[model samples]
Target: MNSIRFTKWLFSTLLFISVAVSSCQKDDNVKSMDSNKSIAAADSASTMGVINTPGNFLAGKGTLKITIEDSTYTFDAATDSVAFINVHSGDSKYFGITAINKAHTMSFGISSVGFAATNVNSKVAGSQFLFKLDEKNPVVQYTLTKYGGKDDSGKISIEKYNNDNLIAKGTFFTFLAKDDKVNSPFYRVEGSFELQLK
Candidate 1:
């Protein structure tokens, strides 16, 4: 009889412990669900200004043709060749540029040109231009033109970029007369062109 009574007490104790553990597990699940909801709500509230939507003009992919006036001076105190221009077109802009022939100019007495000094690894702060949308290393072509009895050539390139909060960025190339043919005492004639979107 004593043995049977002891068996019944053991069974009752195990049943009570199981019921308590199940109640605690249900409470933990409820707390986890509440935490997830709060995080989602905070994320939605953070991106409220300047373009929260993902499919705006700065979201989709498109091409724009921007034209900008050259704004630099040469040794003769005259407006130098248009190197890089920033044309702000809502969808497009015009870069007031001329084309140059690279093969012919290099064949002549002109010196070879190179890119400007800028950090390409990081994005420019608060910029509105996409310089290398299609490719960072742009392939450019030039065509020669006659200006003021001087045999001059123009260089040009086109670039593309994805949609972002800021405008696009790009770089252009120009090879000026580097020899005594320029008739200027200062033999330093080097410049570059740039395009930006705003």
Candidate 2:
């Protein structure tokens, strides 16, 4: 009876040890899988010009899309370019963004002051929108100016801004008047842009 009891105790001990070892291995596997997932997420964000951490900026090509009246124009990183320029003269600072098509005949531009990450979802001050078509012959142009009459109104809302990266994503809607006149013919313009400042 004593020997039998001893054997039973030994068997129970072995069983307990086996389960503990297996549980530890399973937990290790779960930890490893979590680590791999984190790495994958970081890689994905970097590819899209997004940084998960604060104060880090990633530079990447951007896209722009604008619709004038019923005609839509799309410009991508390929065969086109988006430029963001910071102009500073005297005590004034201006932010300018331009998107040009591959053919170089069509372009859209914006100029604003006090446009920054802090101004997200707010209309920028001194904002102006300009659209140019057929740059070669006479340059057909439309504009939305800040102080224009009620008919010539527009707003630019910054949806996303990464100050460290100087990357801005925004949406704009405007009634662009020919020759910047309130009584002139106008076209409804709507667009979105993602730009990396130079």
Candidate 3:
């Protein structure tokens, strides 16, 4: 009787071990397959001209293109609150505009900054405002010819918003004019940008 009991207990233990081992192997296989799929998707995006990057901005018109060195958002260190994106040059010239919108659906707060339209004839919606600045007198300003955002305020429209890739692309017909505050208004600006603000 004792011997029979020992055999039964050993058989049950072996069965449990086999089941656990098989499950582990299957899990590893699934993980490997998922990882491979991710790599393949990445390769396809680059090869197919899918532009997705944290540093992506392009807008121009005619022969002139706004010289954009970088784009960044600032936050107040003390309050941990949103500040602004600096599109300014070293000069104090007004090359950028700043405003706020708390209900920006772009996941970009302030659903596009409010454009007073005194500077632009059309409606405005962007994370940041673009313009030109006078390097010398530091009192000149320019509006946008081409702009980008995840809204419908601008003349341009959002062609695609890839949720899977977190990319927002659009077109715009920007018309940069100098505000009355400056010595004179700048030329009409126009262009398009396909920024991947992931």
Runs with alpha carbons beyond 4 Å of true place in candidate 1:
1-93, 96-152, 176-182, 185-198
Global lDDT scores for all candidate models: 0.24, 0.50, 0.28
Per-candidate alpha-carbon RMSD to the true structure: 30.8, 26.8, 26.0
lDDT of 2 at 173: 72
For candidate 3, the per-residue lDDT at 194 reads 35
Best by lDDT: 2
Of the candidates shown, which would achieve the greatest TM-score relative to the real structure?
A: 2
Judged by whole-model lDDT over C-alpha atoms, candidate 2 comes out at: 0.50
- Error of model 3, residue 93, in angstroms: 30
Q: All candidates' TM-scores?
A: 0.19, 0.54, 0.28
Residue pairs whose backbone atoms clash in candidate 2: none
Off by over 4 Å in 2: 1-60, 122-138, 145-148, 163-166, 196-198
Worst 10 residues of 2 by lDDT: 19-28
What would the C-alpha RMSD of candidate 2 be, to one decimal place? 26.8
